[model samples]
Target: MSETPFDPTVLLSDDLLERFRERAAVHDRENTFPDDDLADLKAAGYLAILVPTELGGAGLGLAEASLLQQRLAGAAPATALAVNMHLVWAGVAKVLADRGIDSLRFVQEGAVTGEVFAFGISEAGNDLVLFGSDTDAAPRPDGTYAFTGTKIFTSLAPVWTQLGLHGLDTTSDDAPQMVYAFVPRSDAVVTRDDWDTLGMRGTQSRTTELHGATAPADRVVRRLAPGPNPDPIVFGIFSVFELLLASVYTGIARRALDLAVATAQRRTSKRTGTSYSQDPDIRWRIADMALAYDALPPQIASLCRAVDEVVPPDGRWFSYMSGVKHRAVTMAKAVVDDAVLVAGGSSYFASAELGRLYRDVLAGLFHPSDPESAHSTVATAWLGPLDT
Candidate 1:
């Protein structure tokens, strides 16, 4: 048999790069949703990358999507975040196509109209505080589920027309079940609460409360056990999300590198006659920065391949998926930490680009499935013999 050509679609192209750079600063300073950036993505057909080709989407694999995310994040992390939620929601809609095509239409139309989307999983006091009692949904007798909870650090909520969320349904008798629901932002009230974070400021991640808001049963894609028994593909998808999120942080690091190098090249140190770029210490820092930045892409790519090969129907894929997410998030934390060090004093000042990258990269550490728990789970897997 003849070998198939290696013709995977390239998710990001040179043209997209041009547009991203052009609008990157405006969105960052304005703290507004990058509608122009999203319109560019939709116009280029990148917004629907996860919707499967059969459903009027590009059907790109997770690796390809991750690559695209890194490319976009290199220009703007906030814009990349908005795009990530769109693809994640589109993935959910794709998996639930049997219920209705409306979700797909919602994503598609949102893309066409330059309307952005965001995910709401963390709650106010529990905001990125380990996914505890932040939010929950209750089933009504009418088959509609009522969600009464506040989601904190919800990015793009102020500008999003649609939102994808995960919440617990305490009404269930068995262990708390995880429910994935999609709702229109227009129907829900967002509390314009402050997200005055140190980095990714443009994200405008705010608090939102859903008061007796009901979502149709068809929109609830998966209701799984609270523990470790999630669908493999879903778990793998989240791993991919972490990996790409790491990539975005890496891209931010790369941008910090560029900014540092540019500044160092132009300015000479006051104490030393030599330029900052020529200083041996600065050179070493730059090298370390480059090394850390270089290390993440291949690691992320390897995990993306492993995740892409996952078959959810097969039971064995669960641990592998969890392991991948664990490793990816760990790497992301370390790589972004290196980014902060590489930028040095400038990394702490709000006026410097490095400062922003440092702040945003730190936020990546708080993501679910980050180093602490990921390492714990991986350790548990390794110590399975002792538990027995």
Candidate 2:
């Protein structure tokens, strides 16, 4: 498949998707990253999808990126999930550049040049989300900052060259300011091989130990007050992360629905001497799955367009973005559950695609802006903040 022309569906051709699908189970069973899939995606210029055309990239917007993610996820959820980390950084750069902030131009340029950026902001027990950091950012005399902390679930851990992370600079005159920067992989950083998980195992989202890994002064992108601030970096990360995450699960739902439909058409009922597709109960379940699955893509597209068009960021964007992610995961799980039922006893096996999807969909609950966080965001948006 040619890299140019940039059709989301065409970019993921049948042969390529088949290769990813064929290797997914092995990667999951071995608890390893999909190295071949990443190479294929890189060859297709998938990493630079969000970078600008002037910067030697496809120059697509969030809507296009999200749709492509959904398509990729349908074939290999782990590959899509792992690649999401890189796309998150590139998407953030795109979002920032759209808002006239060129601080992340290096990110865009790096991606076009085959640089891999991993998200390293997630710290254990730090529920402040993007508002706070448990990692320490000690400033150096040379104006660089030495980041010292353990980041959990650092996707693309084994291969990422630069890590985008945040740390609390407590020693600064403006103490408690969150210092966001990109740390290059070197002797200062350590990646632990402890990514064994229930599903999405191909992600290899291992633990990262940063013992004074330094980002140069030029790479320190932001120093902002923590806690619900309206910084453009914060908005960019939130918008792109939530939308791409939602797109992955939405694609999973589409795959599950398609599988359910295929099973219904192929499996014959011993009782009626006809296919399950003719059965009223089976048809109703398929329709129910389709109904839930159909509402998500348009929602993702609309929100992505809002971001692309720079539709004045507000509190409602948070509610809508988070809500869509929450709904996509919930609906995907529902669709997969129904698919397993439709596929009958065969789907109960560990080797079944629906079985694998069932496990993969559960990881969504643990991602940022999760159900509890999303609910609170929506609640606060409509009901106003609880008495401080």
Candidate 3:
């Protein structure tokens, strides 16, 4: 199949990014969602970037989608992070469709029609990461399932029309089977106002209380074993989620590196009467940032292409994807730290972009495929499963 061509530059132009950047701090200060940013992105048809062109979308693949995400993150990490939750669903649908499953076609069609999908998988103390759900998926006589659980870090909570979540159905014949489905916003769902955070404040990823929030029978997309099975739904969500997330932090790294370079050239030492760019230490730090940031984009592109083309890797795909996410976030945080050092005390102010980037980068550590999880995945892959 010929790849569909979609250029992100047209939609996320420098001008548009600047507008997002202008409002980023304001939204962060007020602890509000980036409503205007979402509106503009929606108007630009960006919300449907991953939907098939025949479905009234941009017809882009994961490679292109990840690139666009990187660009978006550079302008506003919080906005990009919030948007990531929506893109995850669309990307998952694309992944499923590519594998000959129309299970999530509605997700694709919904995005085309301007329906925002929020990721509602994260629950407190559920470290099993999709394998085990703390939420209860109580099956009804009509086959619909009512999910009762509180989802934490529900990004896009204020405006997401649909929420894609998972729960364990203990009452089912196959007890403890995981059920993946989409639940539309309703009275049964409650959006908590507690979203204040250290960074990515514009995301407003508030807590969501799903008290008997139900998904229609038709909306329940997948039922699978509650362990690390090789199910396509598992692959789709894990692959897309990790790649898109890595792209965001990689973009943050690029922005911080650029800012550091610019700062070094502009700042002159009073005693030496020379620009900081001339300092060996400053030059080395910039070089280190560049070296770290340079490796991520290509890695993201390659892995994303593998996902789009459905190329099976020689080894497990989960470990590779998780590693990419881990490295990207680690590199981004490092680059931001280096940039702050190069930019000096001025960058320490909360008003400084670098300061915000510093705080924002910290949030990357909390996302799925976190440091400990990534390490465990890799260790298991290389060393084989430990003795039970």
Candidate 4:
């Protein structure tokens, strides 16, 4: 776990990746969840990858998990994206445990038992993200909280056993506290089958409505004040979420670049009497894709290792992680665009993998720490907050 690299082949073998790749297209076409892919990943102990060895898990650090995600994404972007939610909670548990806090250890333990945890923090239009919540977390006399609100983009909606979420509690001793808690799938939790989208169809990321969904007191994790805070829970979730997101997009970039190279080499031009690989324009485009994609993995890895070692981020964690994510997503989109050009008209077809990547990469722009937010975060870091 101390070392930053893990052998992905042992877990995500070539055969496994191919299976995922094959199923990816079917799932995308049908707009269905990759149920078989999930079964395979669970059978391979991938669900427990971030959990500690003592807990019967992989015991790997964030850096290794990031690499594994990249490998998984290269073959099945939707599956990797769905699984990232599970890893986020597990990563947060490890972060807390390493810091001498054991409240979230149950999440690690649950992963070993094949339980799936989905992130449920996103709302329809709550731009505050982790800093605030619009969902109501009303406390009951029995010490349980009834969370009533809608959470959009709930990945793993069909399979998640537990939903980790946050909501604002207005009646607590500290009014307006953001309560971080988890609720098991129950009658109170309603998931609408409305996940159809332009890309990442295999994810089945539907909308979830919590109709007074109850989280027992023991399930409640953190109760921090609303707004940005340097608490471990906030920092841990932010670090893991941003790093893993970057890894997935970097993997997409890797795939696009690889496909572009293969297409250029195989495509021959009668006008030039040589493969497109010999064309200067195609070569420059491929190189441009590589030049943009190469720096991402290293950047994500270094930040992940820093997160693993618990380095003092000096209040710069937001800017650091968000900047990496924003850049990776934008660069991946550009790479996929170039890849389509290299592949010729064939790539424009809906069945083409490059076309799928082009669509999947667009989802990156909608993820947390978007372009505007990322730029604002960095600007505030370097130049301080705006004037009142």
| Every model: Cα RMSD to truth | 4.7, 2.5, 1.6, 1.4
Task: Assess candidate 3 and give its TM-score to the true structure.
Answer: 0.98
In candidate 4, how many Å is residue 142 off?
A: 2.3
TM-scores, in order shown?
0.78, 0.97, 0.98, 0.98
State the local distance difference test value for candidate 4. Answer: 0.94
Question: What is the C-alpha lDDT profile of model 3 across 185-268, one tens digit per residue?
Answer: 999999999988999999989999999999999899999989987888999999999999999999999999999999999999
Tens-digit lDDT track for model 2 on 170-198? 99898878999999999999999999899
Per-residue lDDT tens digits for candidate 1, residues 190-210, read 566676665676667777888
Better of 1 and 4 by lDDT: 4
**lDDT for residue 14 in candidate 2, whole number 0-100:** 78
Q: What shift in Å separates residue 383 of candidate 4 from its native position after superposition? A: 0.4
Stretches of candidate 3 off by over 4 Å are: 1-6
Q: Which stretches of candidate 4 lie over 4 Å from their true place?
A: 1-5
Q: For each candidate, what is the lDDT?
A: 0.62, 0.92, 0.94, 0.94
Worst 10 residues of 4 by lDDT: 1-10
